[model samples]
Every structure is written in C-alpha cells, then in structure tokens.
Target: MSSDALLHTPLHALHLELGARMVPFAGYSMPVQYPKGLMAEHLHVRAAAGLFDVSHMGQLRLEGPDAAAAFETLVPVDVLGLGLDKQRYGLLLLENGGILDDLMFVNRGEHLFVIVNGACKVADTAHIQARIGQRCAVVPIPEHGLLALQGPKAVDALARVVPGVDKLVFMTGAAFDWNGAALYITRSGYTGEDGFEISVPGPWAESLARALLAQPEVLPIGLGARNSLRLEAGLCLYGNDIDTTTTPVEAGLNWALQKVRRTGGARAGGFAGADKVLAQLDGGAPVQRKRVGLVALERVPVREHTALQSTDGQAIGEVTSGLLAPSVDKPIAMAYVRTEFAAPGTRLNAIVRGKPVPMEVVTMPFTPPRYHRG
Candidate 1:
C-alpha cells in the first residue's frame, strides 16, 4: 500500500469539521466514526437515518450502440433484460470461473452506469476499458461524491431535501436537481435498509451533505458501523467475503445470475468463463463449500481467516468476515464451510486467538432486511 497521505473524498473536509476520526480505507482517508462512537452511529442508522460519504467508489458510464452488448460479455448477469432506470448487482469473473469483483450496473436507457468497489475500482476500470474500449465509450465520472442515506427513516429524511425520493423503488435510479445542482439519486444501498445513494459533482458535495445532515432524523455515520451493519444484514464485503477465489454459486449469490445468462446462448456464452460457470450450473456442482452464518458461543469476537473445524476436529472451512455485531449485541461471523456441514444448527468450532470456540451454522442476514421494494 502507498505510504503517502491517502486520497480524500469530496466530503473529507466536512467529516473533519464534524470531528470524525479518520482512517485509511481502500486507499482513501475515510471516517471510521464521529465523536458519537460506532454504536451510536449504528443505532442511529437502524432507527433513523445516517449519511455516509462513499465517493471513493468509482463510477463509469458506458455509452454507444453496443454498450449493453459489450458489458454483457464481461459479467454473467443479464444486462439486456435490465429495464431502463433499473439496477442489478453483478460480478466480473475471470476465464477460469474466478470472481474479479462484484459491482452494481444500472441501465439508463441510452447508457449504462456502473459502480464498483473502491479498492478494486482502478483494476476493474482498466479491465473493462481493455475489453470494451473498442466497442463503446467508457467515461469515468470524475470527483463525484456518492452519499448513502440509510435506515428506516431514510425516505422521509431525503424527501425533505429532494421532495420526490420516496417514489423511487429499490434498485432504481434517477436524475434530479438538488439546490441547483444536477444529482443522480439511486434507491439502493449495502446495509439492507431502504435508502438512496446520491451522486453529486465534487464542487457541491459538501453543501449537499450538509443539507442532508440538517434533517432531524439524519446523522453522520462512518465505516466502522457500516461494516457491522452490513454484517448484521448479511451483505458481503467484496474483498473479504467474496473474492477472486470464490464463485457466485459458493458465495450464495446465485440469485444475481439471470436464468437467461445461465443458459448457453448467443449472448450468454460470450462472457469469460461462461463454459465453466454454465457447467457448474448444469451439472449441479458438488456443494463442497458454501457461505454460512456463524453464531459464536463465546464473547470473544472471531476475526477473518479463522479456521472452522468440524465437530470431529476436521477442518471444514474458514471465516471470511466476522465481528462483534453491535446491532445484535453478539459475535456473529460469516464463513464458507463444506456443504455437508453448512446446514442450520450444525455444530462447528472457530479458532479464536488459538482457542477453539464453539459455533453453529445459522441462516444469514442474522437480521431480516428492511429494503423498501414498494
């Protein structure tokens, strides 16, 4: 990692003015939390609304006659079926069936809008540019600020600012004018809460953030609580839970792959590793490993890379993401275990700091999602 001062988002100054404790994440200086602490921020978003600065994420636009066709060849998701203004979560896979990264793509009628993980954005953009540069125009939306307003009251809070945000359904995006600035607002988020991710030009990011924060039900949140909140929601952290070594099938993300994409056809078979992925789908590959939720028996929180052992002392899997879930008030973890040992209520043990701690396989989302589909 570069030792130089990390990159700063458009809202970096505002976070500092608000007394946030900044840390390096995804090569950018980001807020871990405000003086209010992680727990308060976590609960604030769960009950009301919390604004997060996520501008470190990369945004790209693919436009041309062949934009959709070109993009469809990169991921397994059915981009052609994506309706105008609708967004779908997808992954970029290697030719050997390994995942490169997971992303969200929106079909915007005349173009495609893509948002990818911050850490992998550079590499991801380069890969897409290399593959589709000849077919479509790939333009990076520079210095744009992405804000996430999440929680049950998010719609109410945002409606007070943007006026019509409540009408947008889940996985939909639109362009709106906010205080004289053109903004792109998407009704999507990672915390499993009903929320919107607003994209604004860098010049007006601070003003927009302040306006959203002025809402009585809105507060400023940071990355610390964001991780825990997503954990409780069972959302995967790109590099941690889902990586190059993991496939969508093993990561429990099969829903993201459309039926048409899975079937070998003129459009479906063109993407990388389509043969391997389609084979896995058709032959019903052995469930050797699967992502599962773990409830820790002890107070000690299990961290990533912890080895999971079967009841008889055989290694079955490893923890990918784990933390003491502040929202749930317990230690919850996500691990990939052999399919035979992944059923709910199956007994297992996680090695925590050299001590074997009892754990059990449980259904994910540790908590039910609160997405606003209607």
Candidate 2:
C-alpha cells in the first residue's frame, strides 16, 4: 500500500488472514472483496448472512443538561421529540440547506448516541465541536468498534450467538451480552435487509467477529459487495449521491426532516439552514434533482460520473452510483436527474464509454427490501 493510503481498523489483520483483497476506502484500508468476488459476496449476503467490519465509522455521544435542545441547533432533525431507544436518520446541513453529511441519532437513556461516516469523521467532529461548544459535551467513542450483520437469515444467525436478538424491531437498539462481551446491537443496516449493527469495544471486536462467522449462514463480506448491495437497494452513498452541494429537498430526502421540525411550528427546533430547508418544503424547490434508479440495456457496466442524456440528445444529469446489480442480473445505476425527468419509465440514454446506451428510470430498491420490520 502507498504511504498516502489511509489507516486500517483493528480487524485489518484478520481480513488479510481470510484472503480478502484489500483496498483503500473512506480514509481506511478496507476489504473490498474476499476470494469469493463482489458478485458472489453480494448474492451471499442477500440469500444468507454476511458480516462486515465497519469500525472505521465514527461513534460519539452528546450529553448535557440541554443536550437535545443544544444538539438541535446543529442538525435539522427534531431530536427533542425522538423517543427513548428509537433511532432516527438525519442530515447535518449547511446554512444554504446543503447536506454536510447524513447521520443516525439514537436517544440512549439520558444522552444521544450519534454515528457518522468515517470519511467525514474529522470534519463532523470539528463541526459539532465548533457549533455546540460549551453547550454540550461531545465525547468521541474511539475505543469502540462497529460490525454489521446483514441478509435474509441475519436475525436467525445472530439469535443463535446473541440471544434475544429477535425481539429487536427495525431502527431500535438495545444493550446485549454477547459471548461474555457487552455490545450495543441496533436493528438497522444500510443494505435494506433485516440486520443488526453491533458496537463493541475494540479489543473484543476480533473475538465477536470470529464468533459470528462461525455460524453456518454467516460469511465475511467486503466493501465491493457493500457498495453493490446499497446501490441495488437505492441507498445513497454520502459523498457520491449526496454532499455539501446537494440540499435535502433536492436530494429527495425530505422525509428525514420530520413534520415537527418544519418551520413556523411551535415544536420546531431552530437548526442550521432552517430557513432554506423550510422554504423548500412550503414552496417546492425549483431544481429538484432526485436520486432515481436506471436500467441500462448495454452489457457494459455504467460507472459513476457517466453523463445521462434524454432520448432527444439533451443532457439531463449524471450517474452518482452504478454497478452490475447482482440480484437483478442487469446493469443498474442511481442518478440525480431533474424532477421533470425522474418519473419511473422515463426513457433516457446513458453515455457509457462514448456509446449511447438506452436506459429507463425505475422505482428505487431494484429488488424488494426483505426487512423484518416487526
């Protein structure tokens, strides 16, 4: 690896031992795929269960006398209304309603537990510190490690090792004792499946990972498959699909902004970019570029940054995420297209390698999500 390559998580050595092909991603050396390859790994996770080491993600806690009120000034979500033990997805916004990052906030007892992307951890921490300052205590959980167990059989596989896991519904979390180690397990994941993300101390990560893999339905997956799975599921990949230049309204993520958080309301928590986001909500944004799914007829895989053009040869948008969908058996992609051209079944052309490939806008989650919402 080059010196410019980012650091590795504690499970890096274990990945090497499993014959994984390592690659630099999100400022960390991560396993992009094991010997099974991306397609096989993706199918494995969809059909059975797969374990992923996501320790590079940043986990932090905010606590203070007015933690919820103080934290609301930083993000648009209404944290004060969030019930205990419930997790909500939110976005850190700029003054212009642009997305700084997408994060998950969980009301853990008296404090708030937050998780953000690893690539933007430094900036996110700095932003939080600068905004909240002395109003709240922002503590980084550096000694912790994150793991994801995903797939159709994920719940059953985890229940065998960590008992009582079946009781967890989607977006709920609980403290559990796993193989003599304390872990925080959340009934949530990025793959649009019934899964759990476990946060454990760094030292116990390897042991817990080994135990999960010991299950017959569990296999170790990597970043390559992770990307493909999220793409097929129509999930946004922060920096690519959404970033500081894209607003929540334009990105079709207005659902993340709860009704209570809207402007001109008694329950509204005044946060950054409230004016712009609220205005867009009342009088729809002029340029609503939504993340829509696309199916390409050409066999060639369409990668990111590919230009999307209308059938009449007019440029519409660009592909933010693309891959050969393992489940759909076709080249599928997600692009931010103008709202006028974002309806499902709209015909378009993707310029892949100088050729005009016929494409069609389709509904998201190319495959039906098999999440166990109960």
Candidate 3:
C-alpha cells in the first residue's frame, strides 16, 4: 500500500516530535522506535513506566437488552456470563473453527465493549452488523484514542494523574473523569507488566499523552519495544501467530474457552464453530498440531517462519513468533509442532540461515507476568 493511503493515529505528530521511526502497520503509519532505540525502550518498560499509543486498535460497543447474548454468537467465550467491569479474551471463528480475530470483550453494565485487531476491524464490524444488528447496536468508537502505560512503576506514575485506577485489579475496567474528559481505563495491556489501557477522546489524545509523559517515571515508548515486550510475554500477534487458518486449540489458547461454553455447561456449543471446538475439547484428535514454547539451546536467534525439524531430520512444524528474548538473554520462540513433539523438554532443530540450531520445548511467558491481581 502507498504511504498516502495509510491512516494516521491521533498521536502522529507527537511521535514525529519525539524523533520516532515511523513504519506502516495494520494500515496506519505508526512509530516503530524512538531515539532511545528498542533495547533501551524495552528495558525501560521493565524497570520504569513506558507509554504507548495503541490508538490503531479498534474499540467498539454493543448496546441493547440482548447485547451480550447476541454478541456471543461469533466468539467461543462466555460473554453471556460476563459480569460488570470485567474483561475476557475471545476468538471470533469461522464455521470451520479457524480463527478470524482475537479480541477482548468488556462488560459495561448495559453494553458490551470490545477491542479487535486494527486490520480486521472493518470486516469484524460488518460481520457483527450483518449477523446481530437486529438484536444489538454495533457502534464503533473511532473518535477515541487508546494509550497503554506499562511497567513495574506504572501504577505509581498513573496514580499521580488519575485516582481510583489503583483499585482496579487485572482484567477490570471502569469509566473515569480525567482532566475534563471522560476516560475508560482498563487494568490490562499486551505486555505482561502491570499497566493500564486508557481510552480517551481523539481531541484529547495529545494532551493526555503529554501529561503522562511528564511523569518522572513515564517515558514514551514505540512499537518496536511493544512487539519485543509482548513476544517475551508469550502473547500472540493476530496475523502472524493466530489467523484465519488457525484454531484456538491449535494456538495453545484453550484457557480462553470458559467451561460454560464447553459440552456440559448450561449453554454449550452455542457459538460459531462449536462442533469443531467441542470435538477438540473432547480429545477427538481434531488437532494434529499444537503451539508450544521453544528455547534455543544455542545463542542464535531464530525468527518467524523458520522451519522446525525433528532430531531424526523429519519436518515437524515452523516458527510463528521468535525473538532474542531481551529479558531471558537467550533466543526464544513460539512454534506449531506435530502434537507428539509438543511436550516440554522435547528436542527439535530450527533451520536458521542454512544450519540447524537446537531448541527445546518449554513453558511460555519466558518472563513471569506482573499483572496486578489484587
């Protein structure tokens, strides 16, 4: 796509002012890095607080008496049982059980709010409208800008500007008034660190970003760091890791499936692709592959699409997300392998360049999560 065709975020000008290297992502020209570079920005967020402009993500609202029930038709999560101010991860699937997009749905008393991948938002909105428009109003809040402030010190920094956020536990959110604008704040983020995702009107985006940056503990972070941080946290990127051809079970996201949506629950098999999903749940061997964590026994960093081969030289699977995990100081990757090789401590080789690098299947979250569960 041409640069002119790409969209700009509300904080585009601010990104330039900070000398950010802008790159095209999800149809938007976004910041990939800043003057501090990826390593420093990544480490800064691990120590202090870093602010990210996540405005490119889509924020939508479903409103009506049947909002939750109507919305549950597209995803495999228990949206109908979601309580007020709580959020849950969900997957929108096709009839064949392939994932369309992964999203987060928040229960807001009278409405259901959702955040979907930016590249898929247009189609997602259309799908929701066509499927459930009669039962609920699908409203896209395009006028809002989203910001994520993350790290060990994020709470202290944000507490100086916004009160009551400290009381929010992980996956919980609430509406608040901050600096004369209405803000929807969630105690969640892509990075495993404790943080808050603040949604504010686009007109106030720059002002709010500047205010947060003014905090001694907060610095402006760019997308480059965001990617590495999430990679270390073992989180999946929508297009690369989980996509139209992947199922939740194949992607190691079985935890997102609530028991209420399973075979014995009150409203079992009600969502899209329930047959295939339930079959996988029942251990019917519908999935031939499984996603697992891989740690390089060598120092070489293997990247995406790198082929995986068994110790005996037979092809197994391929890497979906790989990085030189900054926190771990060793190469780490997430891959899909034949189910037989998905167990922890299973040995495999990745073809990096032209040579093979040994790797072992291991548990993910290469780094421990620091979410505020209190």
Which lDDT values do the candidates have, in the order given?
Answer: 0.90, 0.88, 0.92
Colliding pairs, model 1:
none
What does candidate 1's lDDT look like per residue over 144-181, in tens digits?
A: 88899999999998998898888999999999998788
TM-score of 2: 0.96
Worst 10 residues of 1 by lDDT: 279-288
Worst 10 residues of 2 by lDDT: 281-290
Writing each residue's lDDT as its tens digit, candidate 3 over 223-275 gives 88998899899999998889988888999898998888885856877888888
Residue 302, model 2: lDDT of: 87
Of the candidates numbered 1 and 2, which has the greater lDDT value?
Answer: 1
lDDT of 2: 0.88
Best-matching candidate per TM-score: 3
Worst 10 residues of 3 by lDDT: 260-269
lDDT for residue 70 in candidate 1, whole number 0-100? 91
